[model samples]
Target chain A: MARLGRVLLLLTTCLGLLGTAGCGDDYDGLVIGVVLPMTGPQATYGEESWNGLQLAEADLRQAGTNIKFKLVLKDEKSTPQEAQTQAKTLMELEGAHVLLGSVASSNTKTIAGAAKENGTPCITPASTNDNLTTGNPWLSRICYKDSVQGGVLATFALSNGWKRAAVCVDNESDYSRGFADNFKGAFEAAGGTTHFEYFKAGNADYSNVIQGVADANPDVIFISGYYEDGGPMIKQAKARWEGKPVIGGDGLDSAEFLTLIGDAQNPIYFSTHFAPDAPDEPAVKAFAERYRERFGKEPGAMAALGYDVLFVLMDAAKRCANPKSAAELNTAIGATKNVKGITGLISLDNPDRTPNKPLVIVKVEGGAKKFHSTIKP
Target chain B: MLADVLLDGLGLGAIYAFIALGYTMVYGIIKLINFAHGEFFMVGAFVGYFALRDLGVDEVDLPQPLPILLAFLVAITLAATAAALLAVLTERLAYRPVRRAGRIAALLTAVGVSFFLQNLAVQVWGAGARAYPEPGIWLYVDDLPAKADADYKIRERVEAVVLKGDAIDTARKAALRAEGIERVYRTPDLTKEGKQGFVLLALLLWTPVLWWLVKRTRMGRAMRAVSEDADAARLMGININLIVAATFFLGAFVAGVGGVAYCATYGSVKPLTGWIPGLKAFIAAVIGGIGSIPGAIVGGLLLGVAEFAIPALLEQLGWADAKAFQDALAYVFLIIVLLVKPTGLLGKPQREKV
Candidate 1:
């Protein structure tokens, strides 16, 4: 019996070795790990971005690129812990050369950490929190940071002569707090007074906070929260503070927000990554048309950014001497400059690996998103 | 401004009261902390959503004010019945099996049921917030000179204006027409006072019914007897099972009503809708002395008012940023109440028979 057990253990060890070797086999292509919230609360954003990624992949193949690409998609389930686990699995198990994805900033932070630990290049299509890319070199995002949008809105508010602003910040969310802080700083610096009201995310009632804002009686109400809370808050606020131009960050970029407010005549404005209607650029128009045809739904900022993330990754890969090597891809991605993206001109030459891009300010008019203006950062 | 804050707080208080009543009553009778109680509130909200939006409650054509009033009544009845049935079902299947096992076992089972229902809701309805259809009611046109062109639209708009309790002059109507708006109706909108008024009215109507049920009815006496001592009450020829189910029915009924009020006030519902408010209501029950009926009401109102009012009061005191600690303040209130009155304000001291 002992002799048979030893033989069986030896056989199992040999099988494990062969499996490991097979996984480590080299492929002459870029293996991009795509982690996204294919389920859970942020599924809409994930599904749209995933569609965009697929379209980009097909387009790249049709356009005929020198470097071969292999994409592996994993569901992060709209959570930070899940995102981290999936990113690690994609890198260690699937032999991915680079990582992409995770729409939410909190989830992207975990992916960024995983990428840094594994010495792999990671880029996000949507996560806009400034701190995610501030110190991480391995991490790069196609979308502009929160500070840019905040500053742009503040400047825009100032230009509009909206002096007094009520900045409603969701204290539970890092994105909301950071965005509100940045806006408050920029707005106050330019001699505009801001009244701050705080709320937690996932709250159904904002009556107290709305009453506070109404009492403050600000010219513009800047909601620094996700659309889930922002929509209801704006609806409640409009009941009291009528005609107040409620401005928000890209967190309010969801079709559900328009539906939530339901055709109210409160001139709502939010700064987002892309506006398909404005500027009428041929590339953007074509991308929008293709997206509508493919998904049979209007493409939002996430879809546009997701489409750009791949092209930017490919652009960097084509420049690299060894496109499959993680280190080479990382270096090449950091050296990206002036790549024409559907959102805007993308560049990642900065040490922080953040691209300087223009943000589109869209307004909720007639229960639809209308392009108000674009702010160059 | 203070009135606005109070009214909003009262509106919130009504919701808390509905949920807290469930917790208090269940704990009062069974000594099982029904953690799944909140999920019933959530289920009721979803039921209300479906009833109003998909079930054709809004499609019933009636006279002015009759449609919306009928809609509210039908929706409330549907929600209450659904919640009551669910409560009874959970008790029969989950809680009853674990009843004699111990308090901890039953409590854990309650929690298990909560997770099950919440996940089930997610599966049934995707984990996204669905917009609650606006509940608007029309009123009779008091005295506006009706326009010949689009007279029905003008009357509808005038009815809406009248329901808002605002006398719109000819110039205002002309401005509205020029803006290309045809029909308007009264909703939680068109008022400085929030949805609290409607919620408060519901509470005022329901609390007395609840009071009469618990205090004045024959079943109320039997429930009180069973709560006092289930074995002794059973020996005395009271149907212990029937009383227990009735208690659950009453508690869940109010929770259902609260759900309707919640959606009507908040304008949206999701799978996880009941969790937070349920937690808050649980805290309210604890503060009010969990097993006491009056305790639940007082506790809920106090908690809700304090939650909204304290932040406003702090802002008045120039602590403009105190809203960040709004949720924290609720826990602190709970802790302080527990510390000062260990048995709660209205709870009787427990006596062990030697």
Candidate 2:
């Protein structure tokens, strides 16, 4: 009986120790996890975002903030399955207090789902799909949603007196369809006519689609595809329909797009997040200058958004009572108002955590994207 | 509109034919469908891309047609050589040992090899699409209806000088260069049609050469013998391995040429570039009667024309989502062909022993 009592005591003691070990109270400082497509087709955006984050890190260090934190980055490889796995690792293994990432909406959706399940705050740098933050309290974006940009483009087109428009969309991308559909709806509601053409991503030929658009004889063309197809399509379209103005949403903003269009001076315009040369935004200009100095390449909307996203996260963390607690940080982020960002004056005080940011229009001329105008949202 | 679509189809068909030839040739010698053949095409394209972008092929200071010709020649040759080597290596390492294995095993091995090559490419060259160096030859389309007066004046200044049928002296060319017109537009024969014709002519010329090689040469006879009965050929002291390797070499060399044609026309190359075209070419090969060379050519042209033309027809018929169904329609065509003629267009039915 005495030996049995001693064994029960040992068993209870071990169970108590294991339970305490499993509790794993949050880390001493804050852990911010970054998931991006560092490789695969979307690597260009991933690389730019990474460069922006590096600049953000530099900014933090230079400012000499006393916040104890670490930033961990993982490559999603442009696959949603990989993104989920990485997000899980970031949350459970690294004990991330916050999550930032994923350029495209499809992958971002997967990451956000994982973040919600883990009760971690997730901020996407450039994903602009309308339904991302619909019911997910933990999800938010630094950039404007698809509806805003789509509506803005429609207004811009109407203001320019382009009544008839042809919108080309990538059939494979939900982002493309969402943005194009929104634009089409808004444009038609505004008493404009729209013709739709479809193309798949990774297709090298756009001549057939370009011909179809030319046959429609619209005053303007809207390419709702990424830079990969958009650039070549614009090049071909300019050859076929010389004078028709081509416009697109933020998907067309990339360095590769410029290279693909290569010296074609046709009137091409795209809506983007931030414009370095927009004279009024001194913050944008300074950020662009620093990005160029740091990376030696022109910073696109994505890079600027990446920089802004990190700062926004840091700002929210600063407001948090317990910065290491994800719930606290998330609440703090939702309360963000008038955070001066490179993109614009960001405020996420509304129901959905999307910033009411200004959209900038850029023109492709003389082999570079020049800032043309900014539309207030 | 039909003519334009057909020309575009023909250009696309030429690329399919180049890849289809490889599929047909490899299946002819050894009944294994070489799924990795597409990667061979991709490898060739990357080699060509590197040659143009990094090897200073574009920096060569040759005049007019010479530099253009030199660039194409160098890129194609390097691409072909690399593709051929990779094919031979693939056959020796992956296919050779699996030859005696059942057909399913060999097929599964081919798929494995395909995945290996794709991931290898992704590892080495990255998954991003790289812009191909445009040879700076503007395609001249004379049939494009003349624009309004204001736009026509600007077009005239930048239009190709070759349209006048007058020889461009070096000094006048220099003057045009100073005006930045020569850079925008130059050389009538180097137009898009000209490039397509060049690629098609090269591809078409090879059919006769391939026929002459297989029908007349000793190596050709040996390949036929091995195809008839590998055991018999081995017993007759013929080196079946050498013949199979040579067949892979020949097929991959052609696929490399196809790679160059594709990238040159498309102006970009990525690791996944080969996947769809490869699958389509394989379908073309099947449609042409998988083992027959001439059948691949015919099937490729037919499939290419149908793929482009049907969507165009649908578009004209007011089907807005016609292009969305483009890929689906290609498979539908494949299914229809299979149902109509199970043996394919030119395939001879084999006698089955009960």
Candidate 3:
């Protein structure tokens, strides 16, 4: 009986070691970990992004490649600290070599640090904060940076002959601060004066800020904030400043924003990655139609960016050798070429893996988003 | 700016006061902080939403005010009744076993009950924000012109120029068009006359009804007795459980009305919509002298005013750059009130007989 118990204990110890050893295995299939805010205040956005990633994965599976892609999803709960923990767990426990993540810029910052330390390639779908890819070599994003968006809006204002602008920014969010700083720089450089007002996120009332902007009497108002506060701000601003044009960044590309404002005549414009209507690219059209069919609603730019991130990973995986290790997979992802995506042609320009993608400008007209134009990098 | 802020604050404060009544009343009797009170408020909101939206109550329009009044009455009653049943069931199933337990156990049980209800609500309603369809009567209230100049100018202009011009134009163009002279100058009044009328009617009718119930009724006397000393009241031929249930019903009824009032005013409702108001109302109750009814009213109103006024005052004082500090204004007010008058402005301090 004692000898039988010793044999059983030995067997259990061997199984545990085998399980731990599986982490370093050279697997035939490619497993990518996706960290997102699957549940919380931003759950809707996270779920939509996940849906887009699934659609892209399906497309990859049908292509009949030797590489079978596996996705390990982790919920970040929309917090930077949680994102960092999830990133570490995904890398250490889940054995994910490549990562697609994180809706918010703050989350992206932490996950980027994790990916860098682990020597894994992390791609962001919708984090537009400029600092994400500014100096990070391991981090790449499918979305346009806030600086590009800010420059695009500034150019639009300049070409339209708007001489003065006022800016309202959310001080807590990195996305808002980055966009505000870049827009201010570009607008002032283009000979336009700007009056700036800063407010905290999660605040619903914007009457005082709106009043301040109206008092300044600028030609246009640029609001750098997410859709939650952006919607109320635009609505209240319309009530106070009748016909003034309100411009914002990619955060305004949400149906919720229009629903909150309850109007299409607010002359609100935003810079986004893709538009539902543009040059009739079959890839873009198919993505939009498939997304609408699946989700029972039109997909936004964030969803498109998520779809593109998966394809970018797939293309990189196809270039790599079979039974690839983490280092080989990371190398392949770093050498990604010009791949056409819903967001435009994606190509990693720098060895640091910063993607050069197109940014499109759109306006809310008649309660629908109408495509204006696209700016190429 | 100050006037607008104050008016907004007052409207918001009224809502807080209504919700605070439930917390203070329950705590007054049981000495247990019912953390699930917020979930009750949430359930009430969903009830109102489902009634108006899914139950087709908002779609049916009758000739007189009877249909509107009936729909509102039914919805409010259903919500209030459900909330009362839930409170009682929670007490029986979760709290009864732990009734004589330590204060910490009761508090933890309250938290557990809160989580259970929130999760249950999410499962039933789905994990997304649900829209509360505004009743037809309340749909266009905010669109109403608040200023006399705007209202009178539009009305006079329509009557003098547009109506007369349209009549003349239609008469002249009748031969060209085969249709009769159709006046295209019809414009409904944009003022909030309907809402003001409803509020006045409610205040006139419900105030007297509530006053009669609380001041002149036998159940009211029993409720007051239970609130003062439940054990003594039980010993004095009063059924303590029945009195407690009645109190819950009354409190939840007020909360049901508050739910409808919130939806009517805000025009939107989310799953967690009750959270902000629930927290603020709890704070209001604490500020108003926790067990004092009138104090809850004053506390709620004061909290609302402070929410708006503190930020404005700070901004005016050139501290607008620190807008994040605005969210902490309520806590600051609560701390000051606690320091100045521990039992609240109108609350009587209790003496320990031991």
List TM-scores for all candidates, in order.
Answer: 0.86, 0.87, 0.82
Tell me the spans in candidate 2 whose CA falls farther than 4 Å from its real position.
A1-27, A263-265, B54-63, B97-101, B136-191, B316-320, B350-354
Q: Candidate 2 — number of clashing residue pairs?
A: 0
Off by over 4 Å in 1: A1-31, A38-41, A61-77, A320-322, B55-59, B137-194, B215-222, B229-246, B352-354
Distance from true position, residue B104, model 2, in Å?
4.0
Please provide, for model 2 over B1-354, each residue's C-alpha lDDT reduced to its tens digit, 9 standing for 90 to 100.
888878777888888989999999899888999999999999999999887665644345555456577777898999999999999988877787778888898899899889778867887987767677654333222322233111111222333333333444556556655665533333222335556667778877888998888889999999899878888899999998899999999999999999988877776788888888999999999998898889889888888888889898887898868888877887898889989998779876755734
Across all models, the iRMS values in order are: 9.6, 13.2, 11.2
Q: Report, for all candidates in order, the number of backbone clashes.
A: 0, 0, 0
Pairs in steric clash, model 2: none
Where's the lowest-lDDT run of ten residues in candidate 3 chain A? A19-28
Worst 10 residues of 2 chain B by lDDT: B147-156
Pairs of residues at least 3 apart in sequence or in different chains that clash in candidate 1 = none
Name the TM-score of candidate 1.
Answer: 0.86
After superposition, the stretches of candidate 3 with alpha carbons farther than 4 Å from their true spots are A1-28, A116-119, A134-136, A196-207, A210-217, A236-238, A322-324, B54-97, B113-216, B322-324, B350-354
> A1-377 in candidate 1: lDDT tens per residue?
43554475478679857743424247666789999997677777888898889889989999999887788888887889999998998889888999998898999999999999989999999988888987788999888888888899999899989999988887877788889999989999999999888888776988778877888888998999888888777766655777778889888887778768853556889999888887768898899899999888898888988899999999999998898788899999999999999999998998767888878899887567889898886
lDDT of 3 by residue, B11-115 (tens): 667777778777777777667777777777777877877776556453344543454666677776777667667777666666656757867898898887776
lDDT of 2 by residue, A1-377 (tens): 43554475478679856742422245677888899998777887898998998899899889987688777888898999999998998888778888998898999999999999989999999999999999999998889999999999999999999999998988789899999999998999999999988888876777677887888899999999888888777655555776788899888888778767643546889999987788867777888899999889899888998898988988988897788787888999999998988888888888989998879999887556799998986
Distance (Å) between predicted and true CA of A157, model 1? 0.7
